[model samples]
Target: MSPVCLIARDEWRALLRNRAGLLASGLLVLLVLVASFTSLERRAAIEADRERYQASVDEQFDQQPDRHPHRMVHYGQFVFRPIAPLAFFDTGVDSYTGNTIFLEGHRQNSANFAEARQSSLLMRFGQLTPAFVLQTLAPLLLIFLGFASISRERERGTLRLMAAQGVAARQVMLGKLLAHGVIALIIGLPAFLVLSGFAATGAAGWATVLPMIAGYAAWLLLWAVLSVVVSGLFHRSRDALAILIGVWMVGVILLPRVLPVMAEQRTQLDTNIETEIALHRKLADIGDSHDPEDPYFNDFREQVLDEYGVESIEDLPVQYAGLVSIEGERLTTGIYADSAARSSARENAQNALVHDFSIISPLIAIRQLSMTLAGSDLASHYDFLQQTEAFRYNFVQRLNRMQAELIPGIGGEDPRISAEYWQEIPRFHYQAPSPFSRPSDLIWPAAVLLGWLVALSALAAWASNRLERNLR
Candidate 1:
C-alpha cells in the first residue's frame, strides 16, 4: 500500500477509537437532522400563513363597497411578499427586511412588518437554518474533531516515531487531512441531504440547489483544510483548539453582526415618515385637481379642449374633472416613484457596503448567496415593490380612465360610472424572478467563497511543507 494510504487508514482508526470524537460527530449529525426537520417545518408554516393572508387580502379587494375610484385608492391594496421555496435553508436577510407592504396612490409606504422589529434581540444571534448550521456550527464541530490531528501526535512524540518508520511527514499530514475531511463531509451530510430533498420534492430548483450545494461544500472543505493546517502548525493540541475556536467566533459570529451595523451607520437612509412627508410636499407643489381655477389644471383643460376641438369641457367627449384627476394622479405617482427609487438606492448602498466585507468573511458571502438564490434578498424585495407600484398605477389609472370615458356618456349632476367597471379591473399578481435569471447577484459571493477555499488550500500545502522540513 502507498505510505499516504497507510497513514490515512491509521488516522481513521485512531479517530474511531476516540470516544469523545465519536460522540461529538454523532451529536453534530443529530443536530444537522434536527435543524433540517425544524427548518422545513418552519418554511412550510410561513408559506401557508403568507398564502392565507394573500387570499384574504384578495378577497377584501374584491368585496369593497361602492365608492369613488379616488376613495378606493386611499383604501389601498396590501401586498405580501411570498417566502421563497428554499428560504427554509437560509432565511438570510428575510428577518431583517419587512414582508408586508401597503400600496396606495400618491404615496409610497415602507414595508411595515419587519421580523427584526417584531423579534427580540436574540434573533440577532442567528436563525437555525441549514446555512446557519453549515456556516457557524459545522466549522466548530470540525475543529473539535480534528484540531489535535497532528498537534497531539507531536505532543506525544508519535510524529517522530512515524517519521523514523519511513512514513514521510507529507504523507502523515495528507492522511490526517483525508480522515478529517471525511469527518467534515459527514458533519455536513444531513443538511446537504435536506437541501437535496427540498430540490427533489420541487420546493427548490436545480439552479438554486446546485449552487448552494457547491458553495456549502466549498465552505466546509475550507474549514477542514484550515483545521488541519492549524493543528500541524501548533505544537500543542490545546493551543490548536483554542486558536481555531477563536477564529470561528470572530469570523462566523462577530463580523456578520458588526458589519451590518457599520453599514447602516455609514449610509443613513431617510425614515419612512420623512420620505412620505417629502412625497406629499412634492405633490402639493403641483396644482390640486379639485381646484378648477388651478393654473396647471387650466392649461391641462385648454390642452384637452384643443385635442377634442371643443370650446368647453362639457362639450368634449370625455369628463373634464376625471381627466384632471388622471393628470393629477400621474403627477403624484411620478413623484412617489422617484422618491421610492431614491430610498431603494440608499438601501442598496448599505447592502453593497456589507457585501464588500464578504471578502474578509465568507459567512457574509454565503449568507448573501443563499438569500439571493432563494429569492428572499433585497433585490427580490425591491422587485416586489416595483411590481406593486406598477399594479397600483395601472389599477388607479384604469379607474380614472373609466371616470373619463364612462361618466361623460352617463351624464348627470354627479355622474356615477357603473359599479361593474370595478369587476373589469385586473387583480394584482406577483411574478417572482427565476433563479437562472439572477446570476450577477450570486456571482460575487460565490467568488469570495471559492477564493477562501483556494487561499486555505495553499496555506495547508505550505504547512505540510514545513512539517516535512521539521521531521527531516
Candidate 2:
C-alpha cells in the first residue's frame, strides 16, 4: 500500500476505537434521520392544509347568491404559498414568513399567522431540519473529532518518530486530510441519500438537488481540511481544540446573527405603518372620486366620454359610476404596486448586503445556496407575492368589467349580476419560481465556499512543511 493510504487506514482505525467519536457520530446520524422523516411529514401537513383552505375559499366565492358586482369584489380571495418539494430539507424562511396572503381589491393585505410568531422563544434559536443540522452543528462535530488529529501525534512525540522513519511531511498531512475527509463524507452520506431519494422519485428537481448535494459535500470537506490543518499548526492537542471551537463559535454561530443586523442598520427600511400612511397620502393626491371639482377625475371623465363618443359621462353606454370605479381602481392599483415595488427593493437591498458579506462567513454563503436550491428563500416568497398581486388585479378588474358591461344594461334596483359569472372569474394559481433562472445567485456564494477550501489547502501545505522542518 502507498504510505499515505497506510497512514489514512491507521487513522480510521483509531477513530473507530475512540468512544467519544463513535458516540457523537451515531447520535448525529440518528438526529438527521429523525429530522428527515419529521420534516417531510410536517411539510406534507402544511401543504394539505393550504390546499384544503384554497378549495374552501374558491367554493365560497362561487356559491355567492345574486349580489352587486362591487360587493363581490369586496369578498376578496386567499392565496397560499406552495411549498417547494425540497422544503422539508431546508425550511429556510418559511417558518417566519407567513405562507398565506389575503388578496383583495384596493388593499394589499399582509401575510399573517407564521409559525415563529406562535412558538416560544426556544424556537428562535434554530430549527431541527436537515439544513440546520448540517449548517450549524455538523461542523462542530467535525471539530470535536478531528481537532486533535495531528496535534495529538505531535504532543505524544509520534510525529518526530514518523519523520525519523523517513515518512514525508506531505504524506503525513495527506493521510490526515484523507482520514478526516472520509469521515466528513460518511457524516454527510445519510442526509445526501435522503435528499437523493427525494430527487430520484421526482420530489425535487434533479439539477438543483444534485448541485445542493455537491455544495454540502464541499462544505463538509472544507471543514475537515480546516480541522486537519489546524491540528498540524498546533503542537498541543488542547490548543488546537480551543482554536477550532473559537472558529466554529464565530463563523457558524456569531456572524450569521450579527451580519444581518449590520446589513439592516446600513440599509434603512420603512415600517408597515409608515408605508401605509405614505400610500394613503399618495392616493389622496391622486384625487378623490367623491369630489366633483377634483381635476384628476374631471380629466378622467372627459377621457371616458371621448372614448365612447358621448358629450357627457351619464349619456355613455356603461354606468358612469361603474366606469369611474374601474378608473379609480386602476389608479389605486398602480400606486399600491409602486409602493410594493419600492418596499421589495429596499428589503432585497438589505439582503444584498448580507450576501455580499457571505465571504466572511462561508456558512452564510452555503445557506444562501441551500435556500435558493430548495426554493424556500426570501426571493421565492417575494415571487409568490408578485403572482398573488397580479392575480388580485385581474380578478377585481373582471368584476368591475362585469359591472360596467352587464349591470348598466339591466337597470335594476339592486344592480346585481348573475351568480354564474363568479365561476368564470379565475382563481389564484401560484407559479412556482424556477430555480434554473437564478444560477447567478448561487455563483458568488459557491465561489466563496470554494475560495475558503483553496485558501485553507495552501495554509495546510505551509503548516505541513513547517512541521516537517521543526521535527528535523
Candidate 3:
C-alpha cells in the first residue's frame, strides 16, 4: 500500500484504540438514529393531525345551511398548510410559523397556533432532528475525534519518527485527511441512510434529498479538515483542542444565536398590531359602502350602473349591495396583498442580512440549505400564506357573485342565496412550493458550504507544508 494509505490505517487503529473517542462516536450514532425515529413519528403525527383538521374544516364549510352570501363571507374557512415529507429531518422555522390560517372576506388573518407557543420551555433550546444533530452536534464530535490528529504526534515525537522513516509531510497530512474524512462520512452515514430510506419510500424527491445530503456531507468534511489542519498548527493537543472548541462555539453556537438578533435589529419588521392598524387605516380611507354619500361608493355605484346600462342602483338586474361587496373585497384584497408583500420583503431582507454572514459561519449556509430542501423554511410558509389568500379571494368572490346574480330582485334587507351555492366554492388545495423553485436560495448556501470545504482543503495543504518545515 502507499505510505499515505498506511498512515491512514495506523491513524484509524489509533482511534479504535482510544476507548473514550470510540464511545463518544458510538453514542452520537445512536443519538442520530433515535433522533431520526423520533422525528419521523413526530412528523407523521403532525401530518395526520393537520390532515384531520383540514378535513373537518372542509366538511364544516360544505355543510353550512342556506344563508345570505354576505353572511357566508364572514363565516370564513380554515386552511392548514400541509407538512412536507422531509420536515421530519429538519423542523426548521415551521415550529414558529403557524401552519393554519383563517381566511375570510375583506380581511386577511395571520396564521395562528404555532407549535412553539404550545410547547414547553425546552423547545427554546432547539429540536432534536437529524439536521440539528448533523449541523450542531456533529461538528463537536469531529472536534473530539480529530482535534489531536497532528498535535498529539508532535507531543509524543511520533511525527519526527515518521519523518526519519522517510514519510513525506504531504503523505502524513493526506493520511490524516483521509482518515478523518472517512470518519466524517461515517458520522453522517446514519442521517444519509435515513434520507435514502425516505427517498426509497417516496416520501421525498431524489432531487431535494441528493442536494441535502451533499450539503451536509460537505459540512461534516469541512469540520474534519478544519480539525486536522488546526491540530497541525499547534504543538500541544490541549491547545489544538481548545482552538477547535472555540471555533465550534463561535461558528456553530454563538454566531447562529447572535446573528439573528443582529439581523432583526438591522431591519425592523412591523408588529402584528401595527400591521392591522395600518390595514384598518387604509380600509377606512376607502369610504364605507354603507355611507350613501361616500364619493368612492358613489363612483363605484355609477360604474356598476353603467356596466349594467341602467339608470340607478335599483334598476340593476343583480343585487346592488352584492356589487358593492364585491368591489369592497377587491379593494381590501389589493391593499392586503400590498401589505403582505411589504412584510415578505422585510422578512426576506432580514434573512438576506443574516445569510450574508454565512461566510463567517458556515452553519448558516448548511441551515439554509437544509430548511429550503425540507420545504419547512420561511419561504415555504410565505408561499402557503400567499396561496391561502388567493383561495380566500376566489372563495369569497364566488359567494359575492352568487349573491349578486341569484338573490331575487334585490330589495330585501336579508336576502338568502341557495345553500347549493356553498358547494360551488372551492376547497383550499395547497400546492407546496417546489423545493427548487428558487435556485438562488439553494445555490448561494450550497456554494458557501462547498467554498468552505475547498478553502479548508487549501488550508490543510498550507498546514502540511508548515509541518514539513517544522520537522526539517
Candidate 4:
C-alpha cells in the first residue's frame, strides 16, 4: 500500500478504537434501520386505506340510481393519487400536499385530507424516513465522528511525529478525507440496502431508484468532505464541531423553511377563494345563456339554429337548453382552466426561486432530488390534478351530449341517463408517468448537487495545501 493508504488505514483504526465514535455510529445506524422499517410500514398502511376508499367511491358512483346527467356532474367523483413506491424512503411533500382530489363540474377542488394538515404540529418537523435521517441527522453523526480527524493529532503533536516519520502533510490530509469518506459510506449502506430491497420488490423503477442511490451517496460524501475540510480549517476539534453544528442548523433546519416563505412572498399566487371570486366575475361578464335577450346567447342560439338547419329552437331535433348548458360549461371551463394555469405558473416561479439557491444549501438540492426521484414532488401532484381536470371535462361533456341528443327539445329539465352509462364514463386511472419523462426537472437540482460535490472536492484540495503550509 502507498503511504497515504497506510495513513488512511491508521486513521480508520483510530476511529474504531474510540468508543464514543462507535456508539454514535451504532446509534445512527440503528435509528436509520428503525426509521426505514417504520416509514415503510406507514406507507403501506396509507396505500391500503387510500385504495379501499377509492374502490368504495368507484362502487358507489357506479351503483347510483338513474339520475339527470347534470345532477351527476354536480355529484362529482373522488379521485385518489397513487402513492409512489419510493415515497417510503422519502415522504417528500406528500404529507403536506393532499392526495384526494374532488372532480366536480364547474369547479376544481384542491387535493384534500393532507396528513400534515390533520396531524399534530410535530409533523412539520419532518417525518422519520431514510432520506430524513441521511439529510438531517447523518451529517451530524459524521461531524461528531470526524471533527477531530486532524485537530486531535495536531493538538497532541502527532502531526510532527508523522512528518518526522516521512509522511507528507497533504498525504496526511488525504488520509483523513479517505477515512471519513469511508465512514460516511458505511453509515449510508443500510439505507442503500433498504432502497435496493424496495427495488427487489418491484415497487419502484430501477431507472429512478439507481439514480436515487447515487444522489444520496453523493449527498453523504458532500457532508463527509465538508466536515473533514472544516476540521482542517480549525486548530481545535471543539471549534470544528461548533461550526459544523451551526452549518447543520442553518442548512438543514432554518433555510429550508425560510427560503420557501421568501419565495412565496416574492411570487405570491392567488388563493382559492380569490380565484373563485374572480372567476365568478369573469363568467358574469361573458353573458348568461339563460337570458333570452342577451346578445351573446341570441347569437349562440342563432348559430345553433343555422347549424341544425332549423328556423327556431322548437323545430330543432335536440334540446336547446342542453346545447346552452354545453356552451355555458365550455365558457366556465375555459376561465377556470386559465386561472389554474396562472396559479400553477406563479407557484412554479416561487419554487424556481428557492431552487436557484441550491448553491447556498445542498440540502435543498438533495430534498428536491429525493422527492423528484420518489415521484412525490409538487410537479407530480400537479400532473394528477391536470389529468383529473381533463377527465372531469370529458365525463361532464359526455353527459351533456347525452342530454342534448336524448332529451325532449323543449322540456328536458328532468332528463335521466341509464345507470349503465355511469360505468362507461371510466373510473379515474392514474397513468403514473415515469419519473424520467421530465428529465429537466431532476437535472438542474442534480447539477447543483454535482456543483457542490465539485466545490467540496476543490475545498478539500485547498485544505490539503493549507495543511502543508502550516506544517512548514
Candidate 5:
C-alpha cells in the first residue's frame, strides 16, 4: 500500500478502537435517520391537511346561494401555498413564514398562522430536519474525530519517527486529509441518501437534488480539511481540540445568530401595522369612489361614458355602481402592488446583507443554498404572495364584470346574480416558481461553499509545509 493509504488505514483503525468516538458516530447516524423519517411524516401530514382544507373551502365557495356579485367579492377565497417535495428535507423558513393567504377584494391580507408566531422561543433554535443535521451537527463530529489526527503523533514523537523512516510531511497531511475527508463523506451519506430517495419518488428532480448534495458535500469536506490542518499546527492534541471547538462554536453557531440581528438592524423592514398605515395613506391620496362629486371618480365616469358613446352615467348600459367598483379595484390594486414590491425589496436586502458575510461563516452560505434548492426560502414565499395577488385581481375583476353587465336591467334594490355564476369562478391553484428561476441565488451561495473548500486546501498546504520544517 502507498504511504498515504497506510496512514489512513491506521487512523481508521484508531477511530474504531475508541469506543466513545464510535458511539458518537453511531448516534449521529441514528439522529439523521430519525430526523429524516420524522420530517417526512410531518411534511406528509401538513400537506394532507392543507390539501383537505383547500378542497373544502373551494367547494364551499362554489355552493354559495344566489347573491349580488358584489357580495361575493367580500366573501373572498383562501389559497394555501403547496409544500415543495424537497421541503421535507429542509423546512427552512417555512416554519416562520406562513403558507396560506386570504384573498379578498380591495384589501391585501398578509399570510398568517406561521408556527413561529404561535410557538415558544425554543423554536428559533431550529427543527430536527436532515439539513439541520448535516449543516450543524456533522461538522462538530468531524472536529471530534480529526482534531487529534496529527497533534497526537507529534506529542508522542511518532511524527519524528515517521520523518526519520522517510515518510514525507506532505504524505502525512494527505493521509490525514484522505482519512477525515472520507469520514466526512460517510457522515453526510445518510442525508444524501434521504435526498436521493426524494428524487427517486419524483417529489424532487435529480437536477436540483444533485446540486444540493454537492453543496453539502463541499461543506463537510471543508470542515474535514480545517480539522486536519488545525491538528497539524498545534503541538498538543488538547490545544488542537480547544481551538477547533472554539472555531466551531463561533463559525457554526454564533455568527449565524448574530449576523441576522445585524442585518435586521442595518436594513429595517416595516412592521405589519406600519405597512397598513402607509397603504391606507396612499389610498387616501386617490379620491374615494363613493363620493359622486369626487374629481377622480368624475373623470373615471367620463372616460367610461366616452368609451361607450354615452354622455351621462345613467345613459350607459352597464350598472354605474358596478363600473365604479371596477375602477376602485384597479386603483387600489396599483397601491397594493407598490407596497408589496417595497416590502419584498427590503426583506431581500436584509438577506443580501447576511449573504455578504457568508465568507466568515459558511453556515449562512449552505443555508441559503439548501433552502433555495428545497423551494422553502424567502424568495419562494414572496413568489407565493405574488401569485396569490394575481389570482385575486383576476377573480375580483370577473365578479365586477358580472355585476356591470348582469345587474343593470334588474329592477330590485338587492339584485341577485344566478348561483350558477359562482360555480363558474375558477379556484386558485398555485404553481411554485422553479428553483433555478433566479440563477444568481443558487450560483452565489454555491460559490461561497466552494470558495471555503479552496481556501482550506491552501491552508492545508501551508500547514503541511510548516510540519516538515518543524521536524527538521
Candidate 6:
C-alpha cells in the first residue's frame, strides 16, 4: 500500500479505538440530528403563524364598513412578513427584526413585536439552528476530536518511530487531515441533507440552498484544517486542545457579541421616538389638509382650478377637497418615505460595520451569510417595509380618488364614498428578492471562510515541514 494510504488507515483505526473520540463524534451526530428536527419544526410553526395572521389582516381590511377614507387610513391595515423556507437552517436576525408592521397613511411605523424585544436576555446566547450548530458548535467538536491527532503521537514518541521507519512527515499530516476532514463531513452531513430535502421539495430555491451548503462545508473544513495544524505544531496534546478551545471561544462567542455592541455605539442610530417627532415636525411644515386657508393648500387649490379651468372649487367637475387631500397625502407620504430611507440607511451602515468585523471572525460572516440567504436578515425586513409602504400609498390614493370622483356626484355635506371602493384597492403582496439578487451580501462571509481555509492550509504545510526537521 502507498505510504499515505497506510498512514491514513492506521490513523482511522486509532481514532476508532479512542473512546473519547468515538463518544464526541457520536454526540455531535446526535446534536446535528436533533438540531435539524427542532429547527425544521420551529420554522414551520413560524411560517404558519405568519400566514394565518396575514389572512386575518386581509379579511379585516375587506370587511371595513362605509366610513370616511381618512378613518380607514387611521384604522390602517397590518402586514406580516413571511418566513423564508431556508430559515429552518438559520434563524439569523429574524429574532432581532420585527415581523409585524402597521401600515397607515401619513405615518411610517417602525416594525413592532420583534422577538428580541419579547424574549429574555438568554436569547442572545444564540439560537439553535442547523447553521448555528455547524458554524459555532461543529468547529469546537472537530477541534476536540482532532486537536490531539499529531500531538499525541509526538508525546508518545511514536512519531519519531514512524520517521525511523521512513514514513514522511507530509504523509502523517495528510493522513491525519484526511481522517479529521471525513469526520467533519460526517458531522455536517445530516444538516446538508435536510437543507437539500427542503430545496428538492420546493421550500427554498436551489440558488440559496447550494451556496448555503457550500458555505457551511467550507466553514467546517476550515476548522478541521486548523485543528490538524495546531495538533501538529504542539508537543503536548493538552496544550493543543487548550489553544484550540481558546481560539474557538474568541472567534465564535466573544466577537459576535462585542462587534455588534461596538457597531451600535459607533453609529448611534436615532430612536423611533425621535424619528416620529422629526416626521411630525416635517408634516407640520407641509401644511394641514383640513385648513382651508393654509398657503400650501391655497397654492394647491389654484393649481387644481387651473388644471380643470374652473372659477371656484365647488364649481369644478371633481371634489376639490379630496384632490387637495390626495395631494397633501402624497406630500406627507413622500416625506415619510424619505425619512424611512434615511433611517434604514443608518441601520444598514451599522450592520455593515458589524459585517466588517466578520473578516476577523468567520462565525459572524457565516451567520450574516446564512441569515441573508434565509431571507430573515435586516435586508429582508427592510424589503418588506418598503413594499408595505408602497402598498399603503397605493391603497390610500385609490380611496382618495374614489372620494374625489364619486363623493362629489353623491352631493352631501359629508359625502362618503361607497364601501365598494375598498374592494377595488389591491391587497399587499410581498415580493421577496431571490438569493442571487442578494449574493453580494454573502460574498464577504464566503471570502472570510475561504481565507481561513487558505491560511490554515499554509500553516499545516509549515508545521509538517517543521515536524520533518524535528524528526531528523
- lDDT string, candidate 3, 1-472, tens digits: 9999998999999999999999999999999999999999998898899999999988888889879887888899988888888999999999999988998888889899999999889986898999999999999999999999998888899999999999988899999999999999999999999999999999888998999899899999999999999999899999999999999999999998998899889889999899989998999999775454577888788878888899977687887777787888898899999999999898899899999999999999999999999999998998888888988999989888887888855447776766777887778898998878889989999899888988988998999999999999
lDDT comparing candidate 5 with the true structure: 0.91
Candidate 6 residue spans exceeding 4 A from truth: none
Reference-based TM-score, model 1 = 0.94
> How would you encode candidate 5's per-residue C-alpha lDDT over 67-119 as one tens digit per residue?
99988999999998889999988898999989888888988888988978888
**Candidate models: Cα lDDT each:** 0.81, 0.88, 0.90, 0.86, 0.91, 0.83
Q: List the residue pairs that clash in candidate 1.
A: none
Clash counts per candidate, in order, are 0, 0, 0, 0, 0, 0
Give the local distance difference test score of model 2.
0.88
The digit string of per-residue lDDT tens for model 2 on 254-310 reads 889998899889888899789989999998888864344467888888888888999
The worst-scoring run of ten residues by lDDT in candidate 5 lies at: 287-296
Better of 4 and 5 by TM-score: 5
Steric clash count of candidate 3? 0
Q: Name the weakest run of 10 consecutive residues (lDDT summed) in model 3.
A: 408-417
TM-score of each: 0.94, 0.98, 0.98, 0.96, 0.98, 0.96
lDDT of 6 by residue, 1-472 (tens): 8887777788789888989878977877788889889988887888899889889988887788787776777778888888777777788777877888888766777778888788878876777777777887789889888898899899899999999998999999998888888878888898889888889999887878998888888889888889999999999999999999999999998988898788889888888789878888989999987565678787788888899988997788887767877988899988988887787788888889988887778888888778888887888877888888888888777777776787777876766666776776777778988766776797788889899888888898899999999999
